[model samples]
Target: MDPLGALQEPLFTVLETPVSWTEVLGFGSGALCVWLVARQHLANWAVGIANNLLFILLFTDAGLYADAGLQIVFIALACFGWWSWTHGGGPADRLPVRRTARHEWAWLLAAGAAGCAGLTLLLDRATDSTVPQWDALTTVLSLMATYGQCRKLVESWWIWIAADLVYIPLYAYKELYLTSLLYVGFLALCAAGLRSWRRDLVARIAVTA
Candidate 1:
C-alpha cells in the first residue's frame, strides 16, 4: 500500500454516493478558496467564508461535527483576516506578510495544545463522537493554522500542509474519496503557498530595510 494510494483500502460507505451537488460545489469553492489563499489575496476570505458555509452543511449531514464546527470558526477567521489585511497592524500598514512574533508563537502553541486536549476530553465524554481525539486535534490545529493565516504569517501554510496531509487520510478512512483527494491537492498547494509567501516576506523585509 503506497502512501499515495493509501486512501483506497477498505473504503468506507456511511454516505455512499459520490459526486453529489453538495460535494461537487464544495470541491469548486474549496479549490478556489485555496487558490486565493496561495496568492495571499485578501479576497480569499470571501471565498473562504462561502466555502465554510457550504462545508458546514455538508459536514453536519455527514456527521463530522468537528469539521463542521471548524468551518464555523473559519467564518470568523475569514472576516478577521480580511479586516486585518486591510487594517489593524501596529499603527500603520507595516504588517504585510510577516513571520509570527515570539510572543504570538508562545500563545499560539499554548492555546492550540490546550484547546485540542480540552476538546478531545469533552467530546469523548459528552458527544457520540467516533474519533473524538483525532477530530479534536484537527479542529485545534486548524484553528491555529487559520489564525496564522489571518495574520498573514508564512508559517500558516506549513501548519495547513501538516494538517491536510493527515486530513487526506482521515477523509479516506471515512470514504470521502474525492474530498480526500482534495485534501491531497490542498497539501501540495500549501507547500507552494509556503514557498511563495516566504519570498513575499523576504521582499517586504528588504523594502523596509
Candidate 2:
C-alpha cells in the first residue's frame, strides 16, 4: 500500500473515466484563482501561478499539448501581472480599472481571429491535438484576456466568458471532466467580474469628474 499511489488512485468515476487527485487539486486552485480575480484582488496572480503549474502537468498528461504550452505562457504572465498589479500604477497605489475603448475592441477582435487561424493551422499540422479549432480559439482569446487583466481593463472578463464557453465543451469532449467543470465555474466568475469591474469603473469616473 504506497501512500503516493493512493493519492494517484481514482477518487471517483465520471462517465466511466476515473477522476484522479491531480485534477482535483488543479480544479480547486483554479476556482480559487478565478474568485480572487473576480474580486479584483492582487493575490489572484500568485494563486494563478500555482494553478498554471498544476495545469501544465495535467494538460500535458491529457495530451492537450497546446493547453500545456499555454500554461507556460500563463506562468510567465502571472509573474508579470503580479508585478504590474503591485507596481505598474506608478504614482498611484495600484493600477486603476478602466473600460476597453471601441477602437481597442476592434483591434482585439482582429488579433483574436488572426491568432485562432494561425494556431489552428499550426496545431492541426504540427501536433496531434483533436480539438484544434476550439483549442486555438480559447488559447488566443485567453492571451488577449490575460493582457487585458494585467492592464486592469474591465473587458477582460468579457473575453474570458467567451473563451470559457468554448472551453467547457472542448474539455468535456476530451474527457477532462474536472477541467471542464472548472471552466463552467469560470463562466460564472467572469460574469461576476464584469459587474464588479463595471462598478469600479463607474466609481473611478465619478471621482475623476
Off by over 4 Å in 1: 1-17, 88-95
At residue 45, what lDDT does model 1 achieve? 89
lDDT against the true structure, per candidate, is 0.79, 0.86
lDDT by residue (tens digit), candidate 2, 1-209: 97545545788889999987878888999999989988879889988988887777777777788888998999888888888888866437688888788988899889988988999999999988888888788899899999899888898998899889889988898898988999999999899889998998898889889
Alpha-carbon error at 57 in model 2, in Å? 1.3
Q: Residue-wise lDDT of candidate 1 within 114-140, one digit each (tens)?
A: 998899998888778787888888888
Which number leads on TM-score? 2
Candidate 2 global lDDT: 0.86
Model 2 off-target regions past 4 Å?
1-9
Question: Which one is best on lDDT?
Answer: 2
Clashes of 1: 0
